[model samples]
Target: MKACLILLLLAAVLPVSAQQLPVDAVKGDYIVGALQLPEAGVLELQSPDGQLLRRQAAPAGESEFRFVALQSGRYRAGLASPQSQGRVWLTEQRPLEAQLPEVAAPEAPLASPKLRALANELGAGTPAFWAAVQASGAPWIEPIPDHPQSWQVSFLWRGDASTRSVRLFWPVRQGDQERFARLPGTDVWHYSVRLPSGTRLAYQLAPDVPQLKGAGRQAQRRAILARVQADPLNLRRWAAGTPALGGFDNIQAEHSLLELPGAPPEPWLEPRAEVPRGRVEHLRFQSQQLGNERRLTVYLPAQKSAEALPLLLLFDEDAYVTRVPTTTILDNLIASGRIPPLMAVLVGNPTRESRSEELPCNPRFADMMAGELLPWLAARYPVTREAGRTVVAGSSYGGLASAWLALRHPERFGRVLSLSGSFWWAPARPPGFVAGGLDDAAEGEWLTRQYVAAPRSDVVFYLSPGLLERSAPSDGPGILETNRHLRDVLMARGQRVIYREFAGGHDYVNWRSELAEGLIALLGAP
Candidate 1:
């Protein structure tokens, strides 16, 4: 009797503080929505103010939900997938409105005056006729960034007699998030952050400057950005001195302890380090929480440069041909030139609970992609900045996420390639948020309804699922019926839809076979 009364009182008090409102009706408010897809991942909701609130699962079909508006200001509807997050512009001016009660800002970060001077000097090195700017410097000209990812960036210029540490300082996310870079293999910083996916913050660096008192407690490790100079043109031009190759020569930890067959001619050749290719990179990585640092690996077509080329943004690092053996399909296709030589970013997924964070349908993910990932990638490669030229692709939970990114940020990406998308899965729900998700049959109908409802999106999609007839006769019937229904609904809505089926189950092999065909459809090749 006492327990029952406590439960009743708890429920009553909860609504008074954490109000429960319908999702779809969330006008002028921000929320995160997630749904469990039938096969792979969860569907999530993201908004413009860096928050995730709504969620719905996929039916191997359409998934939907509604939010109630307890307050009105500016709101956007967001969706989450494995590697990406997106939001619909429900309002024009999407500013950050307080989700909870208003709070005061944290104290300003203590500035290292010496580091600041070095950073400021680096920021002013614009070129005159390009070559003259290069010749004007006699001793040393360090790389300076205009819009660094962190509040401070510092580095040491190995020089004779004495060495100076250059640093740059900037605000990170105006107080929301920031970016930082640290020494290779030394993420001595960033031990306190437990952020969601797609969080963007500002950062800077100082060359060999004194370390801050609470470095790890406040920021992620430092990352290197492309050269920044005094002029906008300098941002476009490369630095005179090459960035450090870091440790391409010392490949893996196992290299020192191995004596295997065909260890290759030079056993000293390490994986990719600095740039975006090979088995590893010199670039620093971040985790959604205080965890281990991830080494980035980039896959670029031969002859890739900072020029206009077909770009495919991959969320899961392992989805590439090498990891997932995706190269087989690409080899057959690209060798025959079925698809153009494109750049692929195989960023590894986040750590424990990062799946829910990065794949969140929250505004933070979009900011991360736009303010974080894109800027990082653009620094390394000559990327196609236009949405019409770029594509986003993923599989399982990743696939669902790919679709969500296209749905919200159509202006940044054009084509979406989803394979074995786990639209049925989502980032795990917080404790006590036991909201029932859509079942297969019901979800299929909702997708059908969305096709009938929402405006025709300015994106192209390729969907392929295998035989589910043996799994659950109900789900099998649901798949076929839902597929056909969505196809017709999309086509009737004037969408260019491409649907196909394979002879396997829900795995990488099936998705691999379908990749070529999907490429042809999206790439517009014969």
Candidate 2:
């Protein structure tokens, strides 16, 4: 009783403010708050990366602020005062309150003519009209009711009338095609189309065709391709530095991702209070084959035991560690007993060229892993050496490498997790083509054909691809179709495979959850 009282007294005397600010909000809505400052001061809204999105000065006593049309992500709203710091989440639209000084008198600001005109056009007070208008562009993705197969995608082309029209360069079932759409209103242009469930797609906005600058027609086309950009408003973006993985040649390009209804939910993606977290040890690995050092981020379970644990080998270690919350996911899974205590070795590629060369069915790379890396890891850590207990996994080209490694040395890697594997790779193509090139060989399932012809291994396979993915070339089908073909071939050959179609493009945003699922399915016990 004495200790409880002392704690209560300490809490009461602590300098930290007891009041919590409102944090939850919907992606498409507004969050209104008032901050009481030193008379009048500057308030700033910042992105998670500290980019200043908006800054305004208001009279000190009490000033009102509204975070309007926020994307689905976390943001920080702050002033110069240390006590006023607060975080907000836009995914779960909830009410929030600010800890500001009491207002003396509230002032109603005059509405702009554009807003007033918009209100008049949509019958100001009608909720449905307001909601529809609010969702009219690219970052604002909404499902159209009564048409279960269709979704409305909006893009705001804020450029002048001379901008011609905006086009979405995306893949469709009939073949890769560019759909040109006009702006219905002042700035927003929208497109509604039917897509299969559980489709993940990445797209860019091609607005304003540029004039050819001292180049031929081909150069002009290349320039136009370079101008394609990810949706500015869509915060759920793909990882950088792995361009051409999505079939685009522009290294500077960023593609926006979209998840249709069927995408699997990864509840373990977030940290849970009751779940015990794991320890991540970073190490530098010197590869004899590559003749350079690479980084490896390893995840070890919270509860260590004398028994060796199954090992999960991942490619693009840096992205998994920084972008996807792999450790958190593992913690939740292990805590809930959904998966056994396992070790994850995320091996990073030294360079873009090296990653492409090594990961895509490179026998020399496979030989190095079998001869050097795996043995080194096994000797150092309490890891299972049984082929069935060792899992090799990766995304895109890395994914191709995982399967190839498993197929070549089934005695070492008995399980394979291929997320959007590049089964379309052909030996006839150039080195750069390994990133995005699809060939006529075996209808874009070249590797799958090779696997079918060869003797089947006892390895288990998990293949995941986005449904919205179309065939890369105009002559062939997209990655999704190729993956399905691979699945069929693998199954027909009597190889065990788990095939799933997620509502995502060829990006980690979708693969992160699939990775979790693959681990649980392969290594977890009921």
User: Which portions of model 1 miss their true places by more than 4 Å?
Assistant: 1-284, 287-296, 304-306, 319-323, 360-363, 424-453, 469-485, 524-526
Task: State each model's CA lDDT, in order.
Answer: 0.40, 0.63
What is the C-alpha local distance difference test score of candidate 1?
Answer: 0.40
Tell me the TM-score of model 1. Answer: 0.41
Find the candidate with the highest lDDT and give its number.
2
Across residues 1-526, which tens digit of lDDT does each residue of candidate 2 receive? 4534533454454333211233333343334444544322345666545577655443323334454333555656566455653332222111212111212211222123333465568754355544654465344445666878765544433444444545565533344334344333433343445565566666666664333323364434443452466776566675433223223332334567766666556687888888778998988889876586777889999988688899999987755765567888888889998888999998876643466667777677888888889999988999999999899998878788888888779899999999888777755564334343333563455577678878988999999887666564654666787788889988998999988877656656677788888888788884
lDDT of 1 at 54: 35
Candidate 2: residue 475 lDDT (0-100): 49
